[model samples]
Target: MNAKFMITPVVFSMLLLASCGGSYSSNSSDSTNSYGSNNNSYGSTANDSNKNDMRSDSKPMILTQKDVLETVKSKINSDIVVMLPKDIPLSSDSHFLSAKTTDAPDAYQVIFYETKNPISVNSDDLKEASKATAIATVSGKSYMTEQEAADATGHMDNVNTGMNGVDLGSNITGYTDAGAGSTFLNWAEGRWSMSVRNTTSADQQDSIDLAKKVVAMLEKETLPAPHQVGGMKLEAMPNKADGNIISWQNDKTDYTVSNFKDPLDGVKITTSFTK
Candidate 1:
């Protein structure tokens, strides 16, 4: 069977940090506005009645990390595992926009923003109305096998001339690619191929050091094993003014944690999920 695993692209340059305090039209698609470089804008949509109800409330509705996870769980099949951060390091000002399944039935996503306004169940004007300090997402989808999933993460465009070895301490020797203001440290654990990147830094040592720290952490709190092979990618780009992103796969599902400021926090969020 043809493997259907694809790595979600990380578009850091186009991220918008705005408040979600404006009104949204109810006619927008359910998955139209979100925080990413996937050509989709960031905003919320709500019916008129729900909008009025939200406007009357003095305090905006706050959805905890657990709340969003539950919401996503309800939308997808119970057999498909979903993972998210146990606790986000953001302030209390963050508001959950929506949590629902994507175009695919087996896939699900949840979005939240660091804003002070309440997003209605149907609020549509989130793209132009809110000022958010940061945007984050937790998304998951199913795949066939770990090896096929791992192979899909290979990015031909990122190939560079500078290369070195990265020893992850488990007899698993990874490699580093440095060039064009970008550095990447890549390795594999069991059936999982892992990589950590720094787009703004070409320092090979920085990528290697961060990779070591992340690998040490994974040794203690492990991720769910994949059936065959899997893939994980972490990125740190402080100059983008947007959040960092971390993605991985396990069993038959591919998971992503995005819009975080720190790379270490991304790893913490990924390991927080349980079977």
Candidate 2:
């Protein structure tokens, strides 16, 4: 993506936030937009970077953190990373987007959605349309000249832009049912996501804001009460050793690389891969 298009992941995620349906035309003025980042001791939840349209991406796809990061490295440039489900496009037509995932790991199974709900605009047309006016006031050529904007509705593809969403809080943990409620207070310990799409600006903002609240909760979210429950030794793979490759083709899960984190250091990059 270009620097002008370098909005935050929250924006894309928020785009498909709810069932928000903005009716953009083919003659809106140019718009400008900016933004940050987060993550986890995560178990690859569809890297749900911001998408447009209220798509359902809370499902656990067969993806790992390493696979996503590597894809970003190989395919995208060095600006920022906006991960989405393979169903949504990389455009400004809708409110949400999702990443692309495969059904059997190796096969290419993807879905992209182009929202019919843009306030419509032209690049050459410099009309005065702010994000706030997109809902009710903004319309076709009222915001821009005919030549100012192009049919930018097709900018995005390969993301699930029509999925649904719910909510999050400190109580939710792991992956739970989408219909449980809007706010899954017990989803997980780190950051959490709901299976519902937030389509409106307020809804998207709420989602992002809720994420922040969870991060705040992370500092205070209670850990499992210390008991006789079994636990594994807590250790980070060396930051400089070959990353452990957990995949299907290999007999074992880990195929450590030659340049993994330092052997003696207290960090490592454990990668989850497909067979």
Candidate 3:
């Protein structure tokens, strides 16, 4: 008997985003939002109480971009492509918070925080910096055979057929729900499955238009080549607060460009990685 592994890289990517402090609030102005809010109390000394509240025993080790990349690369043996933007937008003070890797399924993650304070990649302070502005992740497991991959792909096609709406070029399928104020686009390209999700828009056409823009942007880049192609799934919602997420998967690796506050930022990040 052969062992079978079922990997949901897209969902795993979402969980990683949440664990790293990605915000799902529709109200971008909310100071309490998870990812982009600058109201965190770190590095603040406005009052005596805050000064005393600072951790005295330890300080998070600040890391440069190169350091984080090296740390992540050192741990994983898989030749996975790590996608990241040339520059993180919104704040000049942003810094790398952590680089993590996991086995069994083989995964890696890199988090970028928009903060003025120094936070170690593996410290409690990193968790407190939940308003992380950006995150990039790759994860996946090997399939037993081509039949398994085909079955997974066929199942996904059947599952997502109902939500299909707009037709993005290059076989990309777009689904827009005006009532729910959400849009989801999905496709398979070059041994990879890709998707973009936005829950903040209400107009169906607006959502479709944005999906088109993202698809167009992805067309100009060179995507990672995996060992095999697998199944794809599509899901959407309107007025949801999950922000924007762009996720993709190859035969044995899953990639994500996420935690961005704006939909266009997601596009920028995706294109940057592929470029």
Top candidate by TM-score: 1
- Per-residue lDDT of candidate 1, residues 148-184 (tens digit): 4445433222322235665767565667765687766
Kindly give the number of clashing pairs for every candidate: 23, 98, 7
Per-residue alpha-carbon lDDT of candidate 3 for residues 11-43, written as tens digits (9 for 90 to 100): 688899886664554454476654444555454
> What value of lDDT does candidate 1 attain over all alpha carbons?
0.56
lDDT (Cα, tens digit) per residue for candidate 2, span 95-199? 422222223221222222122222222211113333212110100111132222212111112221233332434333222122322321112222111121222
| C-alpha lDDT score of every prediction, in listed order | 0.56, 0.25, 0.49
* Per-prediction TM-score to the true structure, in the order listed: 0.55, 0.14, 0.48
Off by over 4 Å in 3: 1-63, 75-97, 100-112, 130-136, 143-201, 230-250, 253-275
Tell me each candidate's RMSD, in Å, in order: 27.1, 33.5, 28.8
lDDT of 3 at 153: 38
Return the lDDT, model 3, position 32.
64
Candidate 2 deviant stretches above 4 angstroms: 1-63, 79-275
Error of 1 at 230 (Å): 2.3
